[model samples]
Target: MEIKVIAFDADDTLWVNEPYFQNTEKKFCSLLEEFLPQHALSRELLKIEIENLPLYGYGIKGYILSMIEAALKVTDNNLTNEAIEKIIGYGKELLNEPIELLDNVEEVLQALQGPYRIVVATKGDLLDQERKLKKSGLSRYFHHIEIMSEKGEDDYLKLIKHLDILPNEFMMIGNSLKSDVIPVLNIGGHAIHVPYHTTWAHEQVEAKLDHENFRHVEHLKEVLGLMPV
Candidate 1:
């Protein structure tokens, strides 16, 4: 395998992300508990968030709006302005959360830096993703940073073209099988799945993949061993 470029997913792959979003979700549920049970509110919020994805894309800003919409829906459009403000505040706090690098992230990047063209290929709001990358302190190790709105097969194909590499010459590493692994494999590229303790429900896939271009590792450091020597 002649892998020239190695792209890493940002959220939950390079750093702590989903848990912080989950924490904010709990807070959101509590704020609207009077209108519905915690479980009900969580379901409503997830429904609204999924619906809003096309319009708002992925990020805390979209999440804030979705939470407000959920609160309004659950409250029969009788929620107060104060409740809306609190939801916005929750999102702001989430956006301000510190970047916590995942285990062995830096060590692995340092090991592969000179040998491969390392880059970040992630999906999220452009500003938010850029800010997180700047805060991560791992940006210097990346040769390029592509903040995508989606990670579909076509999107990755474009990225591969822009990187001046064929699909077979590219490799993607991330936690999401839906976004990171399947699409890359479908495009005839290599993918490595480094499972995180928590993953967003939308990114979850139940299928067991068996592909020559795919590798699932329990830890990020194991990627070093998979590289062609």
Candidate 2:
């Protein structure tokens, strides 16, 4: 309730992100359908992504690399040049994808800008996050931007420290519970979950969450109701 600085997660929180990746995955499966079953190839790609997270981090480049690696593995070191081109093109296309702001994202940011210092605490490749922010035209709404390598309790803690605010004075709004909600609550901060339709497997949590500092809403516009107008 004492929240002062409100931090938001980038990706699905502010825009259409995961669905693009999901669609790309579908295309990837189709491209490789000749070599393996669609279900089997999907499973293999997921495994490769999980394994490469630490090595490649998170971004279209890493994702495409994983796809390429998965392709090579599934084909037993036999991958066609055309297939490789298609896979690489997928990544390039994603990188250039237009920034589609979620409904009411700009409106909410405008409403909260004066009363609170808004921040973006998102994890992904630094350059890509920056590029999207530039394209989004929402950069003017934020006081600070924290592109993190990962989002965990420690990362959130560091963010609050940088903002010179105590844990209870901070609130995080995002679409991922595992990345944005649980960690902030664990650190004694408020978290508001605005669920997106699609989530990456690595970001899913089985347990339902309930806590004093936690809140959930069906849309980004609902955030306006939670903040002082």
Q: Give residue 84's error in model 1 in angstroms.
A: 1.1
In terms of TM-score, the best-performing candidate is 1
lDDT for 216 in candidate 1 is 91
- Which residue pairs collide in model 2, if any? none
TM-score of 1: 0.98
Q: Which stretches of candidate 1 lie over 4 Å from their true place?
A: none
Tens digit per residue, CA lDDT, model 1, 1-229: 9999999999999999999999999999888888899998888888888999999999999999999888888999999989988999999999999999999999999998888999999999999999999898998999999999899999999999999999999999999999999999999999999999999888989989989999999999999999953
lDDT of 2 by residue, 18-120 (tens): 9999889999999989899989999999999999999989888899999999999999989999999999999998999899999999889999999999999
Going through the candidates in order, what is the number of backbone clashes in each? 0, 0
Per-model TM-score, in order, reads 0.98, 0.98
